[model samples]
Target: MGGVYVLGGDWLPDAGNRKVLTELPPQLAEARVCGLMQTRRREWDGAVVRDVLSERDARLVLTIPLSTQERRDSLYWMAEKRGRFTVRSCYRELVGEYEGDGWMGWTKRLLANAEALRNRWVECSRICPLCDEEEETSVHVFFTCRVAQRCWAKVRVEFAGDVRQSIQTAFQYMFSVMDADRLGFALIVCWSLWQCRNGAVWRGEAVTED
Candidate 1:
């Protein structure tokens, strides 16, 4: 106990080995000790520090020195490299007003372009064939189109009874209650609506709720 050197300031001891008060609390005392080793220009492997603490706890602190932005970028890079880019990229492609011939492509466009959606309404010849006019877009066809509203009325006559029809804010209206498969189904529903619209336009076919 005679050689014990207590510290009060943040600075580490110099090569001459004078005691510095670190003023660190118990939880931080261990970290300050480590900082001292690092500051003295001492050569200590990171593994040596890990070996001194529990594995989980040490790993948590190992990456602590990184700045906030650095940590975010590292996490994003890891996720992108792991193939999680579909949701955002798909959303952007939709916003760009892209159109496609199949389920994947059409759905992407429908979600993005209001005009393309109206065209489906027109094609169904069940009503109007325009992605514009608010009547043909995804929100309308699913929840508010006169035809669609009627369909839902059958299921819930009181549905939106006195409420005005409203557009969905895509970002705010995510189906969090659904499981992964159901979530996928929601995406598929968007795709199918686009396909139905296209069939109405090119085929001059009549559309049905089914």
Candidate 2:
């Protein structure tokens, strides 16, 4: 309602934009964006935009990528590499706790952390890209690495050194019997660790934010 989207605009508005739009006349403000382009141009009609929006908002539409080739619109989920929603990514976004999804798969040590992949004769370094300090074993990625430590620290949860030490020998057993609240927090953090690891490995994007 803050005038971010038009019925059929060529421009996609920034999701966070909430600016009030009083400049545009009702017909133009509510108008479909079908013919906003100049009569023979791929670019927006600058005067029309500048007349209806502040200079800043007008620039958004002005900078839109236009093409002469015909192409269909598509949708993708930004949260995942495949751009498709899955139970795992969806659960993480909605509940922050992956419930019983691959967050537990981290405990089973099944996903392709670098060390496990290298062990299968795959030609890759076993180093943790996030920490660059240790081999990316399930234990190292989830607990011992500096990056993992910072994630727990951000959540204001501290693990006794023994938590990682003991998990090396009995991780599954520990998770099975841990306090429910603690287990939930642990899994959530593990989900973050997995995401960071994948981003670092696959996309060269190391997520440092908490």
Candidate 3:
């Protein structure tokens, strides 16, 4: 038997695609299908890069298919079987409000406006707008930005512990950062910093965290 790939199902539209289409109209579904096709072809990076889902990807990620509880559990197991990222943390922040049995999240809202961000990245002809640091990309948006580093420093000072500098390490630090309220506040601040980075890139607006 060949490898079981998510995009390798019969060309005939399946319930999955139909569900996805309902959430994201034809144009996005086509783009998603293209991205998934690249994945089927063993192009992991291409698949992820090709994904233009942005905010929609965040929104669609949470929508569970209607089925028996057991099947739903299995589906979740497969969907979440990959390595976790900061994006998931952002998603969790939006889960209670936007996640109504669907994958809607703050990141998804940001992604919905990805084209603007992409345009700013290319045409706006600016360095990292947040701090005028380096070029804006996943690396700069999440880490390596001076403004972001400052926020992290605040967390480090408050925690009064050896705060790891790596983005992954900061996530672990979030676990022990005090009460639930403060932890959530920290997470939202991180998310806001990322969103502000995009706002600067896309809208050419420069504002600092006060």
Candidate 4:
């Protein structure tokens, strides 16, 4: 894929042109003739510059020293210190930065939201929004509810043992048996079911099977 050229600071929109920096603005173009355009911000003071460009982009720019010598531009990996690309480096680049505390954090959030912990604190109804026939416990919302069961039934995978246990155990068992792609599809179904439940509760919409 062709690499993207990101201009720093707030310049005028390039009208979809990537070479906007090469064709500098009239003010900057004139300044470039006087060597003033090459001036670095005093506030930066040898520190990394920040603004429109990302941290990676800023670091990449710094690596290219200002030189009078003209040379053919070449692309290099920005993730690695030596600008060499590797499978691991590419994988890390694709994944980007880690956010939250992974599955454990997600489980806690799911429990808190499904169990209506906030509602309990305020002395409100803890009824399941989708079914309205039982308390909105984590297990009911994620596994046992009529809507949740329908979502799970749509998946092609079969459970060897009982998956009616807690959410964590159920997921653990499911993950152990399924491949990565299958697990991902199952997770998407779970998320979609949750979204549908929220829609029913907040917007009075009917649960959709598809």
Per-residue error (Å), model 4, residue 193: 0.7
The most accurate candidate by lDDT is 2
| Tens-digit lDDT string for candidate 2 (16-50) | 33232335666666654444567666667888767
Ranking by lDDT: 2, 4, 3, 1
Off by over 4 Å in 1: 1-134, 146-171, 175-177
Sort the candidates on TM-score, descending order: 2, 4, 3, 1
For residue 174, give model 1's deviation from the true position in Å.
Answer: 2.3
Assess the local accuracy of residue 132 in candidate 2 as a C-alpha lDDT between 0 and 100. 84
| Evaluation by lDDT, superior candidate among 3 and 4 | 4
Per-residue lDDT over 1-210 for candidate 1, one digit per residue giving the tens place of the 0 to 100 score = 112222432122231222242244576554533442243433333675465545543443354342322122222211234535345443342333334542344344344334453466633323444333453455665555555444444444222232324333432243334444444444444444544555556555467765
Please give each candidate's TM-score.
0.31, 0.46, 0.35, 0.45
Would you give me the overall lDDT of model 2? 0.60
- Residues 31-57, candidate 3, lDDT per residue (tens digit)? 433343333333333334335334433
TM-score of decoy 1: 0.31
In model 2, what are the clashing residue pairs, if there are any?
none
